[model samples]
Target: MVSSKLENEPTGKKLPRIEIRMLSFDLVERVEIARLLTDAGYSVRNELAANFDRFESRVMDDDWDVIFVDARVPYDSVSRALDLVRAIGSDVPVFALVDSHQENQADLMELGIADLFTSDDLQRLPGIITRGLEASDDRKIAIEARRLQNEIEFAGDERAVLAEIGRLVSSSLDIGQVYDQLVEQVKILIPLETAAIAVADVASDSVTIEYLSGRELPGFDRGRVMAMSGFTSINQLPQFVFVFDTELMEQMRTEFPGIRELLNAGVRSVMVAPLVHRDEVVGFFATGTSTENAYEPEHVAAVEQIAAQISGALANSRLHIHISRIARERETLIQIGRDAAAAHDLQSLYGSVFKNLKNLLPVDRGVIALKGEDGKSLAIEYVEGLDIEGLRVGDNLELLESSTAVLTGSQPVTVDNAANREPFDLTDGKLITAGLPSTMRTPLRARDSIVGLIAVSARDDRAFTQDHLSALERVSNQISPVIESLSLLNQVQSLAAAVETTLDLFAITDLQGVTSYLNPAGIRLIGLEEGASGVGVDLKDFMSPEQAEIVSSIGLAQASETGGWQTEISITPRNSERPIPVELLLVPVRNPSGGPGREVTTVNVFMRDLRDREALQVELREFVLTVSHELQTPLT
Candidate 1:
């Protein structure tokens, strides 16, 4: 019959379960031991083995809190059972039950026994098992505490490194310096065989390796540019990627050919984090090692933090560069305006414009065209760095699709590839033939009308961007009015040249009768000295007082009323005392809008001296009178 555990024991508490493995040759001894452990308020499962084979099998098959051996069994057998338990590497406590005279204490102790139990003192076995199990629990707790301590230290070190990296990012806007420091700091936490930072250009769909360090990688180096489609696919990465072994590296080789280079350089692990700013991934931060499974989850988290810091620094750097470039562009624009205003002619103005524009744009060729007088075509006024067969200065080009678009859109237009344009204009065709592929054109507007177009071209495709176009538009707005003014001035200069050579006396005066200009003939007719200007003289000073009154009251009044007046008038010469007769023509020049109630700008006076015609009439009269007298005397 099985002996049950004592129910009404001391302390009135439930017993604990104890699993024991015992090696014994006698059934009586195993049953006695089992009964003692059960009566001590312990629930016990005892496995009794009678042979070494059985004992070794029990030791290998199941786990026990303790093992027991009867010392009465052959000394060698007991020793062998203990040796088997030791060889299997079990930590179970092995206790030997001995007769008091069976003296093998020193030998059993040498064989690694936990304790000795005499048959008389077998009541202490339960307490010994409790002590042994308690010691095991303490060991487990110590091991877990050590693990937690290591983790805390690692966290502290990681935080310190992250703080250092954050400080580096904040202290420098130079990304190169930041990257160099970042690699050094990250090395404290993660082993690195290769490190790189690449910036993405979304407009061009490309990635350029901006910074590279560590082991040299073939086909992956500083300043290397690769298309984003089949390359690293950095633009498509989600937060971070870890290629932790050679097998994973090979699996990623097809999608990311850059991985092959890493593998060739003996790299077996890689960690990549996207550099994100303002919810956009602007670039990537990557690190690799030659050891497989070199990075853990915590290392990945650290790299992500580093990448975030880099992203912020890169954004600040880019913003700084952008602002600096804008400030420079603004200064350049101011200088261009000054050059435009100070230029004396269109050629000089174009030269200055071209020179100043180079500071802001990549211009390989430039052209300026004005709307034709007919308004259906454009006349090429200025051309620089462009030499096409049929296109030259003073050449007429029909309004084509590209130029028409600039005028109609009333904004800047960009041709990314001049060679790819359909229905190409003469300018586009010429540009393609010249291997110039990029072009930006902006309309020149003045007084709310599209007056002309200014264009710039480059040798590379997609060389000009929206920013460049915007800059060009700003320049166009600044110089368009000046161009119009210059053109008008040129026309006025030409008209003045023609008027200067005419034989008739021409004089211009303000509405107050103050003369502002007098041509050569007018100067000679009024008897002014050679090389003397007639400006600031009163028009009435050249006429007799009576004639000045009539001209001021009647001639000026009629000219203002009917747009012109013509009559014979007497004008006293400055060097002659006699008054000379002349035919006077007065014309009123009105403001831009000439209608009733319009303001007069100036009065133009044209005069032809009549002295020679009067002298000829006197000669003819004298000859006729002499001939009549002669004929009458002959008749008497």
Candidate 2:
């Protein structure tokens, strides 16, 4: 028999509201009984005139804690009504209303009437009502306990299936494998016609179907992709990105147009839940069933719980991939630095540094330059990214010239939108023209002076944080000292190997004005006598009258105290018309006894006819300042 009270089952609140149904032979008695019951806080539904049809409807539609049947009704008519109630199921504990003077009370009690009571003894009605409802409530509780036991057994059978699919998803890190297992497992657990896994694309902010299973529904485009903002995913998905359930299939379709055709094609139900990571939606799972009312609230809730558990695992896998790529790039940079240090020559250093770094870092171009004369001008030793003629080799770009300003300070300089700024440096112009909206330049310094620079550019308006800037700074710091050492080693090797063939003058002197060592050019420059030997030869003997006193007073004295000194001294050659201004640098040599005794010192003297170079530098500095000031006028 179909359960008639399926929709009207008493919940916790209704359990205490006593309900009574009155079946009587006449209208007056039934009306009186209903009024009395209602006044006593009992809900009463009456069926008068002994109509068996009315009684059956009342029994099927209403939840009656107690049934009041009049014993004065015709036997056959009343029996028919009683028989209908019996066929409907379960003993409802009917109480037959009898008069105080009625005969055969014991027989009536035995005739399936749980209790018989007169109308005059209405004081006992409250107790009867309470007892009946309690008894009915007890029966309902037992029925629920048995139903729950059956559901638990069914769920146990499905556990094995759920476990197998869960194992597959957990073992496979590939997204395709996880999606395939999801669809297959859902089909086994619940009867469904269609299923799909949709993941959000970070770049586009759109959702695309990564996996789909089951046949296409008739008269509909079953597997059509929905836009990210559409109803297919949002209506079914919970706002919390964890778990939720609802059973309004028809209402969902009416609210979202894209899924209307699917609903009309006998696919009446759907459930969806988001796959979340770090409190954000990474993806989602959606399912559709062809049978009407296929998914209950419990079914939706279970699917949501499973999605929540697996989302965190998938997020971990994604993070691992990102870290692996970054580690590989760092290793490649270390190898390049090592290779450059091994070059042992300027040309080799240029080739290794440029070629290897281009492969290691993502950039459009690079240039290396050395500071010339008090950080005034930079000589471009190497250039990459375009034709060589496009770049001016030896020139002074300003200290605050666009993103390349890293050479002026020990920091990384970044420019996100170079085009918006007026008067930008042209070396990075190609990157801007090609739509590279961001750039980073790292300074390479030696002995606290900017020696060179390394730069990288990108095509997106990306914000680079302090961490990225610090990483580039660290990379440049490690390479700068190694580069300086390699250059110094090369200089030492060149001098030792070509000593005999070198035409440049070399000289060494003792602290007491005695000449210790001199090459052939040094002897010719000073016009030394043929008989003069190295030992006990006063270096003051080579200098003219004025030069002799200047060296004795200033050169040797400062060399002893400061360990090194430099000055320009006038040299009057034998036939020269005017005194030659020769640049002299004195380097102190360590004493063999390890004391502060400056027994020997070396001086490198170079004579340069720099009558115009000094004037040009002054003119260039004045021109640059004037132009920069003029350019700033309109910008303000």
Candidate 3:
């Protein structure tokens, strides 16, 4: 029967659940110890030697707080339990329940028992159990603290290794050579049976063994290409730690088939350190051994640190063939980010991105396209590479007809030789027509979705290398959010621009009588330049003394009513002493932003200049008079 929770016991959250494992041939002895531990608020488990197979499995799989054993039992002795625990490397403490203190005391003490109590001492069982649990908890804390300390030291070492690798990346030009040199340098720093570096091709979504050292892998060859399944390990391996036996290796086959293959070929242990580029798991730096228990946690950490440095060096090598631009690029990114952040509209934001991208790579033409409304089409948002007039903003193109198909497929696409590639296969058809040599397309990724596509073209054959592509990708990541923000800002600015340039004079005055906005026509009516200090001035400054008196008393009071206020009034300009007659319309602007009762910070005012209407009336009167008096006399 399965064990169930005790009714009187507290939940695991409030108190630690104690698990006691018993190993004894005598049924009476097992019952006594279990009942004693249970009465003391512990969860007890019985492991009678009547069925040794099930008993051994339970001891191995479950975490037992303390194993109480009949030390010299005929069928299942405490020595047998000790032998099993040592074989499996279990840390569970063993306590011996000896019959008497007289027989073979030296042999019993050598069994590595945690504590020994005479069988007659039932009174000491409670005290013995309590002390054992306290010691167990202390041991657990000490182990965890030791693990954390090792991690801290490992992190420090990784930083130093990364700094060294940074220097190597800064000075090196050849990526292959940098990786080869890194593998050699890692061997000197870390002990391993074999170490190899595998690099993933972004376009191919496949991995190839780039560098190899140590014991030559029997079946696996250098430059062997395989699917993404071969490269990715199931668990996010931190310590490159996998100890292979038959059962453990087989269970892991589905996630890491290639690693399993190595284990099957008489390999005992292995660890994988990922070669990451811009937070991406591009490939891995792997180390394996033929001897079991050969690698430790510290070794796992050491290899990972070396791999990280190699990854950074490899990524840096690709940026510029002969020139080191990481320092300059870092500064450019900071400045460009500052500039991009100020973009209140799409045009300026897109202009900044494309202009800065040219300094980063050889971008003869650039295209920023996005997924269309219907979900099946890709629409061009901005174009730069060639004269792509047909693929203008809002022009919807079929996803299959463009290189953007690969981007949405969740991988990058590159065309080294545009002449041999299909014209339609490329995102922009004009690339081939204009004799452009190479093109690369990558997804413009945002937080929750792939917002758009970014494609770049070059004029020279195979112009865009891995380093150029990485730089472009880095640029894409930096600008994706800015693009999204700018897109939203452009829509809002368009609406605001329409209101500002309208024929009527408009202004928003706050509750405190300060103007916040004076539109284009409002600025003209106020006789001030666009950038002048008209915005912070009071509404009374635009009205004559008499008009101001009427507004301060009658107009303002009437506007407070629910109907709002509208009447013709005389207005004064800042530059002129003369007052002008104009019709005024005022409406209260509500703040739906928060709070109660249509709370508003400003009132929107519209004033239509009456001068044009007044002139038209005069012209109509002159025409009527001339026809009635002058034309009647001319008829003779």
**Which 10 successive residues of model 2 have the least lDDT summed?**
627-636
- Candidate 1 residue-wise lDDT, 413-486, digit = tens: 23433434532454647776677766778789987888888888887655665677888888889999999778
When 2 and 3 are scored with TM-score, the better candidate is 2
Tens-digit lDDT track of model 2 for 245-303 = 23455556676564565666666666667887776777777677756666665566567
lDDT at residue 462 of model 3 (Cα atoms):
50
Q: Assess every candidate by TM-score.
A: 0.53, 0.42, 0.37
Candidate 1 residue pairs in clash (backbone atoms < 3 Å): none
Q: How high is the lDDT of residue 415 in model 2?
A: 45
Model 3 ranges with Cα > 4 A deviation: 1-54, 57-61, 75-78, 84-88, 101-106, 176-193, 198-284, 291-636
Q: Point out the higher-scoring one by TM-score: 1 or 3.
A: 1
> How many pairs collide in each candidate, listed in order?
0, 3, 4
RMSD of each: 16.0, 16.0, 23.4
Task: Give the candidate number with the greatest lDDT.
Answer: 1
Worst 10 residues of 3 by lDDT: 627-636
The Cα local distance difference test for each model comes to: 0.74, 0.56, 0.64
TM-score of model 3 vs. true structure: 0.37
Instruction: Output the TM-score of candidate 1.
Output: 0.53
Pitting candidate 1 against candidate 3, the one with the higher lDDT is: 1
Best of the candidates, TM-score: 1
